[model samples]
Target: MFKTDHRLMGEKEANNSRKNVQMQEINKRPRINLPALRDFLSQFPGKFQRHLKSRFKRPTETEGANRDIFKLKDANFSLEKQMQAWKKNPVWDDDQPPSIEVVVPEGSLCQVNVKTKVGLPPDAVYNIVTDPDNRRVFKNIKEVLSRKVLLDEGSRQIVELEQAAIWRFLWWSGTISVHVLVDQNREDYSMKFKQVKAGFMKRFEGSWRVEPILLDEKLCHPFKPKTLSEYMSCTQCNGRIASKVTLQQLVEPAIVPPPPISWYLRGITARTVEVLINDLVEEAARIKGVSATDLVTTNLNLDQALSNEIQTLDIKERWALRRRNSRVKERKDRF
Candidate 1:
């Protein structure tokens, strides 16, 4: 009995030792770095606050006057008259590409303006621009990381989105993450967007405007039925309506590249604007049973364009581009 009791005590000691060892092993496992994560998250609120301050900051008297002048210019602009003027002047060709202008206001604040024509109604153009799933149409955009509706009432909506894009520098490339707050005014067919948070941008803001142009009656040809077998035509025609689309953006990269390179990146930005406008125009034309080739004098194939641009880059840039593309593809496949 004594020997058996001693044996039982020994087994108990061994069991306790093993349990303690197991506990130690569990404690040794890696844990989530909560403090580090919290530190990173703490930065977001400050950034967001600064963005709000900038957005709501009142403009100076001179600035306000300049804004009014711009508004008046836009209001007075007539696409039909411009087209007629171009037709009359040999120097102003009908096949001229869209005009893109850039301005630098204050430090790092870059404003870009793009003017183009689309063969569609304002309503259709507005719908395309305000569509929540814009990534489905715009190929350059890698992903719409997240979209949250903050306000949804009749003609106005406030939305927040997280989007990602891959951009290339001279011999390096990187993915840019942007968090944006968008205020949409459907009544005026305008969308205003500003970046609240970004990984590589200090600020990004933009506006889209779509206006309808009414064609003159003289330019319209009345359809008449001559034979009894011919179908009767309506006497009154409102004539074909064309849409004028304007896109404006202000971007300030977090890390601005050196000269020449910076200019090249700006050029890329302009090209991106062109591509987006062209895509919208093409889609609108398709809805109206018109082919893109008919409306756009110069059609750009985004995939091919991107490929050619990548080829122009040096070896390092090409490698970076490949890596980013792979990562983007993997993310897409995962989703």
Candidate 2:
């Protein structure tokens, strides 16, 4: 008897829920208007004018003096006539030159002490030297926007990226020119950048050259006599110095990788990879110190969160696999 009563109560509740849903559907029916909104707007000029003006200013003036000026209907007017009309108009033109141009002294140089030859490859050095982004990389000036490019005699290779002298005066609007030179062998390249018409704090022109030196025992030894006084100290230190010095070590160039078999390869991959790996390792070592073997790690919560995230990802992947299988089956059926 209790089971029968419970079943009856459930059926009664379901019927009541169905009735409530039907009532909601009936109430959601949209009411219709016989007259449209356009008719109402058309009937009221004052309100329409106020609303239209509020929405859009008619890009023209219709006041006492300006009324004649705005009444011209044709969009295509003669340029000569327009110029004549503009001359007659009483509007001020802001495109006038200043009476006295500001004069600034030119030519400046930055004191750059590159300690490691391996720090800059020829191309990287060239790019930094000629790229417009050099300002940001070397100087950290974001406003160094415009630059000009100079090409070789053959008009092929870029050798220089120069900023104009006007650059400092009108920092944003100044012109910059770059000059590039390519010899018979493309490897023999040269670039020269100077502020031509820019107003820079300092103006400078310089060239980069490669030098080679040989490594000797004296140069390699840490305790070897580096100064003349140390050289005179004793034969022990003096014996470390060798007379046969080669021209390879003093100006040793950074190693660059050869081009890959693919034509798409434009840069030295081995050097880039080595530099990136070294930098990453050094940064990691700096951050981690000697904590690799240490047992007391502080990021337990992060480890747990990562584990949970991976599990959730696995579940989502499984669901996606099932969906993909279903789609494949559907496609097969269609075929």
Candidate 3:
């Protein structure tokens, strides 16, 4: 998840003055001899550059030692380990409609959750999603104009270069360039991406998540197993492990359009995600030699949908209900 910038204000003038004085004193110290250092490094010709390049290729961190934590990798929530303190909930049906919702309750930016069940191992699914060569699999991505590796750690790309992907919106019959910085991690099977130098959108960021799930109905309801390995190794389950993938994307445009155009914009975004999930599911089917699995997701706004059945209400009661709903949404989307 990504959030906007926030500025910290100093409450004490004394502290501000003290910080200014400290900064002034530090600036009085002699500056480093950058020209001399550059000259010395230049004398080594390509050796320094080669060493620098190789350094980036070395293993940067131990597995599971990353400071940045992924929420999807949380130990509980039926995805990983189990604790008696946590409540259990059943997974959604496989034939439901697309799963997309507003991440923030009041902001211009919106987040979409697209998920589906794939008849493949987690590693196999992970490889397909992270591989740029398979960009053609995503129908929305017309072409990956350019992709470069900015930094690599061992075999994984820690900080990747900007990848310019041309996306065509079928509704508008036009194309837009999406420039993104990808952070691919093989350790947790997650890929974090953020848009760079925005064009169509002012802000765009999200991640890809892959988790193993059992396909059996008896064992899936309430998800009896505590871990993926346990579910996959069950005797009655037949040693099958299907991957449950989730793609979360947050987008914000430079300017808000009127309701007429806004509806089309939302349609374009949701349609793109639909294509992405369908393509991934189809690919999984082809690889595993099985039928395409239907999406196993649920609507996020069921409560609101149910409330629409109310036949009548007072004007004051309606506004009060509106305020209650707004507060609930804000709480859900709060960072």
Structural similarity to truth (TM-score) of each candidate: 0.56, 0.22, 0.53
Which residue pairs clash within candidate 3? none
Give per-candidate clash totals: 0, 30, 0
Q: Judged by lDDT, which candidate is best?
A: 1
lDDT of 1 by residue, 238-267 (tens): 233456788999888877765445656666
lDDT of 3 by residue, 1-335 (tens): 86643433344666799999999999998898999989877878788777777655443333211112212232323322221111122222456544666454345545678876665656678878977777667666666677888878853685544444444332235456777888887667788999877676888888998765444424444444444444433424343445667898887888766543454455556556766777787776555444443332333235223322221123346557878999999999995
Which residue segments of model 3 deviate by more than 4 Å?
1-98, 103-109, 159-171, 216-237, 291-335
Top TM-score: which candidate number? 1
After the best TM-score superposition of candidate 1, give how far the Cα of residue 12 lies from its true spot, in angstroms: 99
Order the candidate numbers by lDDT, best to worst. Answer: 1, 3, 2
User: What are the lDDT scores of the predictions, listed in order?
Assistant: 0.65, 0.32, 0.58
List, residue by residue over 217-287, the lDDT tens digit for candidate 2. Answer: 24334544333233223332222110110011011112322222111111111222222223322222232
Pick by lDDT: 1 or 3, better one? 1
Clashing pairs in 1: none
TM-score, candidate number 2:
0.22
